[model samples]
Target: MAGFANLSQAARTWSIGFMEFDPQNAFNNAGAVLRQLSALLVSYSLSFVGAVLLLVIGYLVAGLVERWLNAALAHIHGFDLTLRNFFSKIARYAILVLVFIMVLGQFGVQTASIIAAIGAVGLAIGLALQGTLQNIAAGVMLLVLRPFRIGEDVQVGSIRGTINEIGLFATSLHTSDGLYILAPNSSLWSQPVTNYTRNQTRSNAITVRIKPDADIDQAQRALIRLAQSDSRVLADKTPSASVSEVADDAVTLTLTYWTAVGDFGGTKNDLTKRAKLTLDQQGLSKV
Candidate 1:
C-alpha cells in the first residue's frame, strides 16, 4: 500500500512541476520519481523471488507427498493399485492448488476471491465434461467393486482380452492375439463382465464320433483312462464318458472333465490328443 501511494504521489508531483515550468521543482520531482520507482522495483523483485521459491518448494513437496501417500496406501489389504495412484495424484494436485493460492496472495491478490472464482470455473468444467466425469465415476466403481483385476482374462460385451491397466477414463487390455485395446470405463461399467479366471476350476468336454461297430464300453473306458492318467485334470471331480448319440454309421462319445483354470487350455489340448490316441489303441477309431 505504501509503495503504491509513493508512486502515485511522485507521478502527480512530476506532472505539476512540468505544468508550472519551474526548473528547480521539476529537478526535485525527478529525484522523487526515481526514488519511488527504485523502491517499487525492489519490492516487486523480492515478491517475484519469493513466488519463484514458493513454486519450487511447493512442487517438490507435492511430489514427496504423492510418493509418501502411494507408499502408505500400498500397505492396506485389497487396495487396488489404480485407486492408490489416483488418490495420491489427487492429494498432490490439491496441495499444489493451495500453494498457488498462497503465491497469488503474495501478489496482493485476494485469496478468497480467487478461491471463489476457482470454484465457479470448476463447476463450469464439470458441466462441460459430463461424459468424461462419467468415465471417472465408472472407474471408481470398477476399482471398488473389482469386476476384474490386472492380468485377468475377461470378456465384456464383444471385447475379450486380458486386463492390462484400469485408469480413471479407460481400461487397457491386450487381446489373446496381442492386440492392444483402450476401452472407456463407461463402456465396461455398462456391460456384463465375464471373468474367465475367477473360478479355480473349469469344466471342458471333448466329443468324437466313433465307428458304429466300435465297442461302446471299451471306448468309454479308454477316455476315462486318458482323463485319469493326466496330472492336469482335477482329482476331486471324476471324469465322465458317455455315449451321447448313436447313428447308423457313427456313435458319439463325449468325455467331460474338470481341470485347474490355469491349466484349462493346455489340459484340453493335451487330453484331446491323448484321447484320440487311446481310442485308436483300443481299436475305436472315428467313423
Candidate 2:
C-alpha cells in the first residue's frame, strides 16, 4: 500500500511538471518567432522605402533624358520630328525598364531570370503580332528615309492624300475631298510613293478646243497669252503651245507651262477658264 501511494504521488508530480514546462517552452518559442518577424518587417520596410525613392529618382531622370535627347536630335539636318520623338521615347522607356528591374532586385528577384522571362514573352508577342510588328518596322523606315513629310501631297498605290501624321504603326492623311484616312505604315512603305509637292516646280497643261474653221495660229497665241498672264507661271520655262489633235469637228491646242508647286493648282484652274473665254472672244469656238 505505501508503494502504491508513492507511485500515485509521483505520477501527479510528473504531470504538473510537464504542464509547467510546456507553457514556458511555448512562450519562449512564440517570443523568438515574433522577434524574427519584426526584424524581417523592419528590413523589408527599409528596402521598400529605398526602392520607392529610387523609382521616383529614376522617373525624373528619364524625363530629363528624353528632353535632352530630343533637343540634341533637333540640331541634326534632315532628322525628322517624328524620329526624334520616337527615339526619345525609346530612351525613356528603356530607363524605366531598367529601373523596374532594379526595383524587383531589391525584393530578392533574380534579374537574369526576369530578363530571360521577358525575352521569352517578347518573342511570343512578336510571333503573335507579326503584322503589327511589320507595320511598326515600316513606320521606322519611313521616318528614317523621309519619303514624304507632314502636309506633303503623296499618292500611294490608289490612295492620294496629304500626310497628316506619321505614327509608329499607321499614317494619317487628309484626302483632297476632305476625307480622313488611316493607312497602315506597311502599306505606304511597300508601295511606290509619289510625292507631288516635293519638288519646287511642276509642269501642268491645259487643252482647249477651237472650231474647225478657227485659225490654229490665233488659238495657240491666245492660249500662250493666257499662260503668260499668270504670275505663278515660271517665265524661265517659256510657255509653249502645240497642236494636240486636228479633227474635222474641232482643233485641240495644248498649252504647257511650269509653275511653283504651291501655286500649280490655282494657276492651272485660272489658265483653263481664261483660255475658254479668250477663245470665245476670238471667235475660235462655238460652245
Candidate 3:
C-alpha cells in the first residue's frame, strides 16, 4: 500500500526542479513525465494481453491435440501415455517459445542469430559424441522395427537372455544365470537376433538307445505312445522314432516330438523317462 501510494504520487507530481524554470523547460519536463507514464501503461497492458492470449491459445491447442491423439493413435499400445506427455508439454512449450521470441523481436532482438548460435553449439556437441549419437540412432531403429522387446528370451551374438529394457544406448537383459547384462545398441544392431518366444510351439529331438535284440517295431510303437499320451505334446503330426545309428552295444534311436513352448522341456524330460521305464520293463538294455 505504501509503495503503491508513492508510485501514484510520483506519476502525478512531475515538477522538474526546485529552481524557477522557463516555460520551455517546464513543458519539456511535463512531457517527459507523461511519456514515462504512458510507456508504463503500455508495458503493463501488453504483458496482461500476452498472458491472456497465451491461455486461450493454449486451451484450444490442448483440445485439438487431445482429439488428434485419440484419432491417430487408436491402435498403438501405451500411445495415450506417451503422447499425452509428449504433446502437452511440447506444444505448450513451443507456443511459449514462439511467444517469447516474438516479444523479443518486438523489442528489437534478432532471433535468427540466436537460433544459429544454438545450432552451432549443438553441432559441436554432436561431433564430440559421435559414438553415442550412433548408438542412439541404432536404438531408434531397433525400437521402430521391434526385433525384440522386454520379456522376450532372445539370443544376440553370444548373449542369451530375456530382454529387460531397451534404452537410448543399450538394451538390458537378464540371463539364465541370474546375471544382468547391458548390451550396446550398436552391437545388437550388428548381430543376428533369435527370439525364442516369438512362436507358440517348439520341437525337440530326443536320442534314446535300446538293445539290438529288442524289436525296433515295438520300441517305435512305445515311443509314439509315450508322446501321444502326454497332454502337453502335440499329436497332429505323429511323433517319430527311427534307428538313427548303431552303437557298439545298443541301437541308437532318435525320437522327435512337437510340444507347446511352455511345456517343451518338461515334455521332453517326461517322454524320455517313460521310454526308459517301458524299455526296462521289456528287458531292453539300460543304454
List runs of model 1 lying over 4 Å from the truth.
Answer: 1-68, 95-116
Give candidate 1's total backbone clashes: 0
TM-score of each: 0.67, 0.71, 0.69
lDDT of 3 by residue, 78-170 (tens): 443433444455565666666666555654579898778868998999999999988877886787678887788999989999999888688
For each candidate, how many residue pairs have backbone atoms clashing (under 3 Å)? 0, 0, 0
Lowest lDDT 10-mer window, candidate 3? 78-87
Q: What residue pairs are clashing in model 1?
A: none
**Candidate 2, lDDT over the whole model:** 0.93
Error of 1 at 243 (Å): 3.5
Cα lDDT tens digits, model 2, 163-210, are 999998999999989999999999999999999999999999988888
- After the best TM-score superposition of candidate 1, give how far the Cα of residue 231 lies from its true spot, in angstroms: 1.5
Candidate 1 per-residue lDDT over residues 1-287, each given as its tens digit: 99999999999999997788978877999999999999999999998999999999999999999999999999998888879999999999999999999999888999999899999999999999999999999999999899999999999999999999999899999998989999999999999999999888899999977899988988888889889989998889999999899999899999999998999999999888888887777778773
Judged by TM-score relative to the true structure, which candidate is superior, 1 or 2?
2
